[model samples]
Target: MQVKQVETETEQKQAYHVRNTVFVEEQKVPAELEIDELEKEAIHFVGYEDEIPVAASRLRFVDPYGKLERICVLKEYRGRSFGSQIIKAMEAAIREHGFQKSKLNAQTHAEDFYQSLGYQTVSGEFMDAGIPHVTMVKEL
Candidate 1:
């Protein structure tokens, strides 16, 4: 997978497409909840495989940490490591901005996956977008 920061309207759309498919359509998250006020301030990323967008995520500088948000990979592409690739790319961007920590509220089911990438569970289970989640953090 080739991951890149979204730099154009087209790239942004590709990111949204992946997010919508995974979060809204597949998971039934409310469409309104899928998008938030942070969109304009966050740094968006998209991953492409053979020129097709398959994954997406966004980053926000929340004080001492780079907050990862809206991370998702198309259902068909899960287990292919595209999520890890996009996350690595986001971490690189965080480091570029001098952040030493990365944080995210990961869906509970994916907690182990994030742990494998160096994230540690920081909080007990919670809910977001009607889905179970937990806060996780990693030292970059």
Candidate 2:
């Protein structure tokens, strides 16, 4: 499997496919909330396995940090490190763009996973899309 920075409309659609499966469909997140206005300004990444898109993520250059967003992997692709691979790819992209830090709002259930990836919880739990989440940060 390989992760690539999306650079074309086709690749962008592939990224959205994975995200829609994971977030909009499986997780019951509203499509309108899942695919928001920030998309055009973010750098998107898609992970492919055997030429099929399996994971997706995006990064936005927010002031003072690179904000990671919309990270998800297809249900069958979970527990196989695709999530980690996509996040590492995003971090590399953040560094390439000269950012010294990365930030994300992680679902509370997955806080430990982000912690294992070197992100630290920096805020109290909050609700997002009707699910519990918390802000996390990592110095790149």
Candidate 3:
């Protein structure tokens, strides 16, 4: 499994498809929220397994915080560390770009996953995309 940073339009499209499958279709995330206008400025990364796109995520600046969003991996590839790899990719990008901190609104079910990645719960649970979510952050 190779974690590749997407630098071209083709890789960007592949990353979008990964997000659409994991977030829009699988998680039932609204099309409006999942499809945002921030893609143009967001830093994106795509993970490939044997030349096939399998997981992805992106980073964006929201004032003092570096927001990591659109993190998703194919269902068949979930048991592996694709999600972790994508998170690391996003973290590296944020650090390279000189960010003070990072944050992510993680689905409630995935809190443990993010926490394991050094993100701590900073706010009470809330509903996003009609699903329970919590705001978590990691000081960079």
Candidate 4:
């Protein structure tokens, strides 16, 4: 398995496909909410297993920090730590951009997963795309 920062249109499409499958089809997040205006300005990453795209994430520079978003792994790829790999890749990108911190709105159910990666909850539960979520932050 490999994860790399997406730099081409083809790579971007693959990232979108992974996110669409996980967020839209499986999680029932609206298609419109899964893809948003920030996409054009975000740095995308895609993960592959045996040459098949199976995980994705995006990072956006938000002034003093970076915002990690849309992190997802294909259902079949879950439990393999690909999600952690994606986050690591994004954190690397964040550091490269000179950011000292990164933040994400994590699904409430997955808060523990992010916590395991060194992130700390920073906000009370809130709704995003109709799902319970909490803001989390990690120093890069």
In candidate 4, which residue ranges exceed 4 Å CA deviation? Answer: none
RMSD of each: 0.6, 0.6, 1.2, 0.8
Overlapping backbone residue pairs in candidate 2 total 0
For model 4, residues 1-140, the per-residue Cα lDDT tens digits are: 69998989999999999999999999999999999998999989999999999999989988687999999999888999999999998898888888899999999999999999999999999999889999999997
Model 1 stretches astray by more than 4 angstroms: none
- Whole-model Cα lDDT per candidate? 0.95, 0.94, 0.88, 0.93
lDDT of 1 by residue, 36-117 (tens): 8989999999999999999999999998999999999999999988899999999999999999999999999999999999
What lDDT score goes with residue 84 in model 1?
92
**Model 3 regions lying over 4 Å from their true place:** none
Quick one: ranking by TM-score, best first? 1, 2, 4, 3
Tell me model 4's lDDT, rounded to 2 decimals. 0.93
Candidate 1, overall lDDT? 0.95
Query: Model 2: how large is the Cα RMSD against the reference?
Result: 0.6
TM-score, per-candidate, Cα-based: 0.98, 0.98, 0.93, 0.97
lDDT of 2 by residue, 28-60 (tens): 999999999999999999999999999999999
Whose TM-score is higher: candidate 2's or candidate 3's? 2
Order by lDDT, highest first: 1, 2, 4, 3
Q: Give the TM-score of candidate 4.
A: 0.97
88 Cα displacement, candidate 2 (Å)? 0.7
